[model samples]
Target: MVKLLAILIALCLGQAIVAERIVNCYWGTWANYRSGNGKFDVSNIDPWLCTHLSYSFFGIKDNGEIQSLDTWLDYDLGFINQAVGLKQQNSNLKVLAVVGGWNEGSTKYSSMAGDWNKRQNFINSALNLLRNNGFDGLDLDWEYPNQRGGNWDDRANFVTLLREIKEAFAPYGYELGIAVGAGQALASTSYEISNIAQHVSFINVMTYDFAMASDGKTGFNAPQWAVEDAINYWLSQGAPANKLVLGVGMYGRSFQLTDASQNWPGAPCRGVGAAGAYSGDGGYLGYNEICLNNWYTVFDNDNAAPYAYSGDQWVSFDNVLSVQWKMDFALNKNLAGAMVWSLETDDYRGHCGEAYPLLKAINMKLRWT
Candidate 1:
């Protein structure tokens, strides 16, 4: 009995010695415009729940200058100030200004990265914005470097851009990160993963959106298989396991089934699902709406994901259970941590029994005491 007790104690001590993993959450500027109960502002955030908060997004201008997509909220309305001010409550929290989301497109990024002068100009612009706004770092959300309207050379030029940015950020002790695609083909072709990893502080792998309305088939929004494949591919390409952060979707992708009987995965879909109550977007529903609405929840043991069906509409999203599974997977793989797409989509109001339940699950699984 004493020997067994000693072994258990040793294991407990070993766990306690492990460093805490990062919980990076992305906050959308447009979430302030959400109507009704779903609306979210910087004040809605719980600083203690996250180690880092990435503000999305800042745009790249034609002249390779960095600009805020929403100047009024990012500057005029004092959102940036208020966001950074959260550090007072949680001293360990870090805020990063994210640049180039999907809507910003890749045309300007390609142009900026291709030319030496343009790349320097962009780096300088980004540094100025971060320093002026009191941000601790910068996150490059270039969408896809070599795909999505970008040139083939982007695969190589991306590494150069990150190297320059890292060099510039070194003296100031600023952090640099990038968001990468989650598919094997997209990740391998769009990123020189090993080279880029050497420069950036971390890589946020976008593991959601595996299935969409246009795919013509019903499936999980972010299947477990895609997550495993993406992470393994990055690791194989020499990305440090400690610098890869898994991306979790805070919303669900909805699909309109062609026939009610065809509600299972791989079934035919006619079109996108109906518009959400607060998100105001067709074919997508935030966790807030998903929790309130009544649907028969079905867990896909094979995919390690969950989907819900009500009438002819089917929505696939990550719940507390699935999020926990992902967190566990990250721990088992010795990964750096996990990040959420947008904090606004979460059930932040406690309407779903607890405030930020999904995020809470992450915190618990990551052993953040």
Candidate 2:
């Protein structure tokens, strides 16, 4: 009996070795595609930033067709073509499309899953889009699975859809990936990560955005300790380290308020504005969006998590230095790679060079290996 148990342990360890062979870093890009003003440039993608680059396919109408800010654009295949061309030039770069996001949420996931025909149609379209565009894989960003905000009802069924898509994409040699929420609260209540991890090449844990767009508590988007805790939970729940990629926020949240609420004081200011009530942004003034542009500012140290304050309004946003810390942590933990929320948010042209700094630092640290 003891010998049999040893054999079982060995086999399990071997399987784990295989599962964690690849690490991925994900970045989201909804504002870029739909920003309309062209303030952000996708063409400026730094191939050396990470091994893989990903963008979100946002503003997708209910029916599965791609929609732009002003027009029902046909399947031009221009962006994909351009992105693919860039990848072909750089052997180290791999691009993937991230479908669904926080704003769009998972509202239509169940509906798409329930109707087999629709699901297949969507899959076919996505696959074709990928193939024609020369994308290496597809990353599903379905915010939540069994949760309610997006009116999702078929959590198990959604997994079934993933199974089907993986089977379908296999023949074409297209890899499948997924982005999920982090933290114990989300882990216990929302995603079935352990059962689902085996199906994808990597699972991206969105380690940031903890405070929320509506809060007064200033904090980093993705704290390292929080990330550690979250990673430990997922691993405990059966997620392989190699198949797990840590997420870091390239941008910071900014808020605005009077001196009446000087909760967290002496925080750095790249510039201040009323955006992302729980985070920080520069020159972006006034509280016009969803949340309060509250009373806090945040920053993270060797940990990816951030802490901050603005008069009484406090916020925490991770700069490139903080992101580097998390990347090192991921490497130290023997995890796969990192995934950034979106590419456009980083200071590709100017604003701040946090994103580039983090990516460059990650490469520098990994150079020895």
Candidate 3:
């Protein structure tokens, strides 16, 4: 009888803990200028639905200082302040400034993290930016630390940088997070996971882009197996499961098939698919554009993902069903939460059946509502 009572108490405590899981979403600063698609800005964001909103990117200068990727959008036009103002709607919402992206490259991060003086300079700049911009924290989006133009010692240096940042941010009650590669090969090579796990508050494991146009094949961009493998590997590397947030792509990878008849996973492909309606990027389609276009949908039961093929174009992306599956996976793994690639890609305008269907599916599965 006593043991049964203890079990009930623990279950209640677990429920209380789960109630605060992070539902982080990245809001792209450039989505406001998507041309053909209507503008998507901070005003369009539903702050209440997300516990944390990270502004997509800030550039890292060679001098280890953080700069705006877009001067106008980030500061001259006041979008940064507007994003931070979202806290007015949901007082508990945290707005973080994300620095570095694939395009930003790792040369600057490598130099900054490798040197103590440069690392301190960068940390100071980050704190200043966060304070001036009204942001609650920083989210490092460095593509890599020890690879992709970085040095061999970058793995250890990256952890040192994070620890310094965390130490500096602690007194101010600021949060620190990182967006990391989900592939086991990249994770093992680029990160000192055991050391890193102790510094950052959470890690956003990027599980998308598993298959790209460069691969010359058609496959689910973010397969279930890859996601599970990444989570498991991180856990094995001593990362606490509750501090890992699974990343879901709100966009799809596209490919132009060499032969329409052979359009399937691992089939030969010529190049990227034509430009998407909203994303305006070749070989990629945002969920908004995917819903707008009429393509024959194909489901991969084994991978728990969906793909679409039309004429000679093939695209792999996530829909409401797949997002639910990912959320359930997070729950089963006792993960910290789930995060979307970017907020602008979703059907935020209610054009695709319901507004924010992908995000809503995540909320439903996680019971955030």
90-158, model 1: which lDDT tens digit per residue?
998999999999998889999999999999899999889988989999999998887778989998999
TM-score of every prediction relative to native: 0.95, 0.75, 0.95
Q: Residues 1-369, candidate 2, lDDT per residue (tens digit)?
A: 999999999988866553333434454333444333224445667665556767556334566533332222213535555655666666757787767776666667656766677687778777766776677888877777666454434566667778888898888778888888888888666666666776788888888766543453333455667878888888888889888888766555544434534444333333344544212244222111111234343444454455555453444556555766776777777787777655554444542323355545555554323
Task: Write candidate 3's Cα lDDT for 1-369 as tens digits.
Answer: 999999999988877776688889998888889775557988789997788999989988788988888888887888998898989988999999999999988889999999888888899999999988899999999898877899889999998999999999999999999999998999988998999999999999998889988887787898888888888999999999989999989999999999999878889999999998678889988899998888999889899999999889999999988888888889999899989988899988879788899988887776453
Q: Which stretches of candidate 3 lie over 4 Å from their true place?
A: 1-15
State the displacement of the C-alpha of residue 193, model 1, in Å, after optimal TM-score superposition: 0.9
Better of 1 and 2 by lDDT: 1
What is residue 63's positional error in candidate 3, in angstroms? Answer: 1.4
lDDT, residue 185, candidate 1: 81
Give the runs in model 1 whose Cα sits over 4 Å from its true position: 1-19
Candidate 3 residue pairs in backbone clash:
none
User: Considering summed lDDT, which 10 consecutive residues are worst modelled in model 2?
Assistant: 283-292
